[model samples]
Target chain A: MKVASGLLAFVLMFSSQAYARQTFEVDLQLEARVYTENALQSEQKDASLSLAVTPEWYRDWQGGAHSITVTPFARVDSADDERTHGDIRELHWQGVLGQWEILVGISRVFWGRTELLHLVDTINQDDALENLDGEDKLGQPMLRINYVADNGSSTRLFVLPYFRERAFPGEEGRLRPPLPVDDNDPLYQSGAEEKHVDWALRHQGWVGALDYGVAWFSGNQRDPKLVPGSVVPVMTPVGPRLQVQSLRPFYGLMDQFSVDAQYTAGDWLFKLEALWRDEFNSVATALNPAIERRDDYSAASLGFERTFYGVSGNASDIGVLAEYLWDERGDEGSGFQNDLFVGARWAANDVAGTALLAGVVVDLEEYSQFYSVEFSRRIGSASKLSVEARAFHDVPPEDRSFFLVRRDGYLQLEYNLYF
Target chain B: MNHPRRKINVLAAILLSLVAGTSLAQYDGLSAEDKGLAIAREADRRDLGWGDSSATMNMVLRNRQGDESVREMRNKALEVADDGDKSLIIFDEPRDVRGTALLTFSHRVGDDDQWLYLPALKRVKRIASSNKSGPFMGSEFAYEDISSQEVEKYTYRYLRDETLNGQDCFVIERDPVDEDSGYSRQIVWMDKAEYRVQKVEYYDRKDSHLKTLTFHDYQQYLNKHWRAQRLEMVNHQTMKSTTLTFADYTFANGFDDREFNQSGLARMR
Candidate 1:
């Protein structure tokens, strides 16, 4: 409550200042989803509707040398009660001082240069409830400083004070596991829990056609391990039985070093993202009684995109993308231990700005596959309409990662309005 | 004692040759192409030494049906010594693409380097520079149309002189040296007094008249550089048009490599 009042006062002060240049905007979206098959869980719905809004306020002073931005987001969902939520996406003040730049407050930062997976991007936790693409992120409270160089290089240091746990879909939501995740009962390896301080440093530079960055982060890991929670008695047709009703989120402490680079040559762009992670502690799993200690592992995602311009003598262009994903721990570490992704993007380059992207990720060892397609076009100057679909095929029940989502194929449509 | 007379004689010879060289530098004994190249060189030379500049632009696009849309942007440019030039353009309007910036580093002999900064994603993506012929923002202006036009990109031929807008002009035809260019040749009308381009007629790859560009509201900056405040481009094939109106043109802003770098694109306002 005090923080809210303080933010209000800060906004009022900026608004009252005559020298400040203020701007405000809002984005509203209406989304609907329809499933192809019946949900595995009884409480989940076949179709769902949602409405989301994001409003932003910006004030710039001293000729853009200093500025403040406030963006808040809220959503109401019809199917899942837990999916209906609100968050402060961004509330930050940025300033420039000689050769240095400073930013304070909550902000969202993105890193990495790959298309399929971002192995090096770990600054903010994923907003899992929103989408499965992993592009959406929650705002992180941080203090960042950047030192800019003349040769297209930058060194940035981040000091994050709080950790935001990733949110999961509720029991009534689709595209989730059979048992819902118990977000309320979370376990952490860090004694400080959510108050743990995280720090990251990254230096990025470019040489001719190559752009590269090396980053190091030490703190709590963003992705959590799912463990079966306490058993609860549930009434059956004949009698009552004890069953694990939910999955508890377990976060561990870790140190990670990552390297990302992109090379641009004519119409081809080559991208690579690799990371090495060292966990400080390990815990026991529900299925395995013995405590398992995790060893240090390496992961990498390499890809390339080649674009063909002026196709058929029109303004349209098409690009082909391919990427390979690998992890040292194989299936035990990540779902994409040994996977290959191939995709294509078509840009109409018309007045309405129509575009389409379709991709498929195939697990090399398990033979499981995930296919996705997305198409979007501008409705007018301030509105856009998009359609997205995803499906899973040829997944074995023993596959630890994709079996739960094998029957969760969905088609979604979204309309966005900006004002 | 005799060295003083010899020195005086040598000095006289040097001064006489300097006066004679100025008179010999005219178009009397030159070919049509050589004269055209000389004029282009003079125009490029006169526009130098500004160091850096910044401007705000309002681009209005209209289609055959008369539907219109406006795009607002800010641009900053730095002059390089031997290379083409560095420029940064930040979009402001259309709400959707607000805060998006494009950084360009052009060269005289090769493809330019371009990066696009997506504000929502906070990601800077290196784009394929092969889209030089595609329309910019769905407007009549292609990507190459707005890029820095270096003298070495075209081969010139001097045509007959004519009067455009009641000003004496030198007409010239230039063929693009780049094979990927959408146009085969362009006929330009540059005023004789200031060497400023007044009008241009673009010919498509098939040597057909494709578009016409006209400039208006000439303004003088730094008492030497001439800038056109309004530029109108009309596509003859599609009957579509785009008009660019520049305002608040500031020169010598002290901008360095920092503002034009790809890493700084996301931080641009």
Candidate 2:
């Protein structure tokens, strides 16, 4: 209830400010999902719902010499058999100064170039806490700065201090096994806890028609250790005692270095990237006493995009991407995973004002597939509506082998208003 | 009866020829240099008017690889004053660019002061002095390219007489005294009879071919002025081109200088 009230107040305040400005924009999204996976014991269908709202305000000043814009956003979701209320998301603020830009507060930073895959798995979110990351050792307190060069090139740097972790408040009504928590445990207290600072630097440049960038980061890592058969006395029934060791806040350096390049000529664009990281799974997994020294990982991705313009100035774009990851932490020498994805997007400026997009992703190593489709229409001068659907399934490599039936799908509806 | 009618017709024909000869004699005897000077003077006189016109501009931007992208824009302009030193221009279209205003103070043979009002930023920024040669909105038109042509801005010398587009024209070469101008000199071909600009070739500081502009589809307005409804400019180095289509000309509009002020820009919407 407090989260709901706080989110409501934030929205109202920002919305009023946006209304005062002649330039304003708002985007609202509502999503519904149905899950049918083998991980569920009862073979029952579960439904989940979520809502997100974002509002922006802009004003030009100094005789048009510069412009200022502000955006505040929030979200709410409900799941768990539709009986419990959803958690409220955090608020975020973003500002731009001429050619320079800055982003503060809590927001998702989607970097990297893997198709339907993520190479830099630095942050993990909590399942039950909609906006919070239960596994993260740091809450989202980050500062990002960027500088533009004379030749239309740019560089950016980011500094984030802390990590977030989730802990059970009590022993009753536990959804899963609780981590072993003693008085000496560093992350014993509950909810979200901050740990250490993470920093990164990136430089982007253009060589002829190709755009390229290299980024590097050093940060606090998550170290999760699994103790075999070492049950602890948490004083709870029905739930198993899982001895999960959480390493203390140690002074260590976990780094990720990457290089990305893309070239766009006419209607065709090609991109490629390679990422190297220090650990596999969670950074915490590397801290286990049994195997704490093995920490080398790498991933690479390549993609191609093309666009076709129609007679009426409308355009259609198609893109395909392939990604591969080498994880030394997997079974045998290392697990090699690959994902292939293809997408098609259409934009038309006819009377109907319609846009459509569809995509398919196939995970070759895991034998999983994901499909998505979306359509949008402009309803009025400042209003638009969109609908989207996504489906995921797991397939077995051989026909004679038994396959896990993992089916997760969702339907989303969104409305946007611009001024 | 047939003889009398024939004599009457012959006399009328002779009278009409005498009148045509007298009118033609006024301008035909002038030297080529004087003819060139006369064309420039006529342009200065007729172009000075408070008029509003709408134009559709098209630009084709080509790179070294021969790749191209085309962009189109519609413009509405009001020329408020033409005192040879100052002019005010107001544009009102392309909702994103509406409410924008420009004030230009032109000197006879010196640099011009240009101020632009951007409604989105609510600020009237004075354009830097060094950017006069930069392309206007990434188009072939440069900041210094579209200013009013004053007689003193350039020194003209008649090159020769030439047939341009099947019409006899006087080719004049003009050298600009302003050091900031992107072009050192320009060669212009004007129709001797109509005083209309048929073609112009621009030469860079190194005397290299920079661009060419061709005017066509001339229409007489108010019985005193001829305006071309279509103009095409092609940049040789960039391999880019721009086409301008003009229409809806309203002459002698009662526009005041105060209407082009910075405060007035905010109220344009």
Candidate 3:
């Protein structure tokens, strides 16, 4: 009902404008994956199919000097008698007045580097979404303002309040978790409420030929257990009873900060970033009292990339990145870990618009590796198609690998029409 | 003794004729009326050789800020039945604009019927009147300035003979008949040897100096065709200028009328 109302209001608002210039764009994707394990106890194999669609609209007024864009996106998944769907996407409007700009509504604001391999994109969404654990919350509503300085730098501030729902504690024991409420209980009169207030500041500067920035943000976290059936039993002394003793939400204030720098000179590029979080909050840690709360979590990574001209008139680019992650939650008292990855890409320079890309990623701490290969070719002036295949494996005892041994593949065909 | 005195007078007259013949190589300044007459006569000349020559021209437009942009265009044109009043221009390079055509029908006293084939639009559009005086692709050269120059299109007056860059040139002032023309009058400095324009100063309709064009690097083709390889125009009001470079010039390629038709534009590869 809310989605329908929002769509209707948007259409009416757009139709009322006298000289409105609007652009609509849509992107659709489908993927099927199969997972297998060697262990007898674990499920032999599982398959799932997913679909996602994103539609975006932009309206311009006053000769394109000022414009507003909204993207209402959705995703659906059905596998093994389980279904999930949601509508937590972008719905925002931006106004530009001279050198000042303001944005209001639910939107995804990307800051800092590592958009390709996101490690610092952890403001409003869950950690699972950042790690691509599953289809997670899409975006959050926020009010943001930006001011451009005379020296070509800009400062932005945001105020956001949003909500999300997660699996109840001990619900993994059941085939399907019970509904949050019975629909008639007085305590279940309203849905679970979680509110947050976050503030972040970022500054960008040029270090010779490289662009760099530093960002810092602090926010509040609260998740209340308002539903009676949300908590199930894991360990029962007598008969099975509700695992949750209290329905109060865990509340805390969390601060996250990071600094990053990148430079591209000639055929070589370098990137580096370091992040630190104080008093990291985790529901798993909160549920298990034996797991101590981590006071500080720090991670740092560095990457180097270089392009080589092959004798066969082909161009090849190779890059390597080394990263270290530390969390106090590790088993051996102090959490310390390191990972290294190296990748290479080759393309025929003489070809009009054709290239081949392949890479491998390795996690030293987990002793796991993933390899992928992709080929792309330009179809015409404004179209392109690509096919890719990837395989994940656990090293050391590769044959005995269980959850990490899988072949994942995807193919994408895209075309752009410009005016 | 009286006969000898008369012989001395004749001998002096002969010496004077010999000196006059030798010194006649130097250009003599023309009166205001004669200057206008010479420009009119040059415009009326039926054998400028443009109709038979395959030539490339590079035009540069410069703003007051010292920035320069260049545009190179090739022309293959031919006279129609020696009438000297009609001709067709065909462009062969710059793939997007290749096979595009332009036809000019010069008249004795009014605006010419100038038509251009737009490849993208696949149509022939008669240039609008308001755009006639505007810069051609934001260059220093206006569309009307590049069209065929006819005697009746402008009223000319010989200014004064002046030496520009050490070359003695004939300066002529011309005022366009079109009231909407951005320029009120233009002063052209023509070289004496080939009558090729060496420099031009444009005055806005308000009579304010708006721009100046300087032509250099003269290359003589086919012994009789003298063309400037570089022409730079600077807009004083806009502080902008452009430079043009010409190359790959061929003469008399037998360009046909069919190549300039609207249908030919769509068939361009």
Q: Candidate 1, DockQ to 2 decimals? A: 0.60
Best-performing candidate as measured by TM-score = 1
Prediction 1 global C-alpha lDDT: 0.87
Local distance difference test, per candidate? Answer: 0.87, 0.53, 0.52
- What TM-score fits each model? 0.92, 0.48, 0.48
Tens digits of lDDT, candidate 1, A115-158: 88878899999888888888888999999999988666899999
**Residue range A378-406, candidate 3, lDDT tens digits:** 43323345555555666443322213233
Chain B TM-score of every predicted model:
0.91, 0.75, 0.74
Against the true structure, whose DockQ is highest? 1
The DockQ scores of all candidates, in the order shown, are 0.60, 0.03, 0.02
- Compose the digit string of candidate 2's lDDT tens values, residues B64-173: 56554444443434553434444545543222233466766565645555556664334443433333454554456666666767777777777788998899987898
lDDT of 1 by residue, B1-269 (tens): 56998999778767875865322235567788998888888789879887888999999989999999888899999999998999999998766778899999999878898999998778998887877888888788889889998999889989988999899998999988888788999999998878899999999888999899999999999988898999999999999999999999999777888767765687787
Quote the positional error of residue A213 for candidate 2 in Å. Answer: 0.8
Which candidate model has the greater lDDT, 2 or 3?
Answer: 2
lDDT winner between candidates 1 and 3: 1
CAPRI docking class of candidate 1: medium
Question: How do these models rank on lDDT, best leading?
Answer: 1, 2, 3
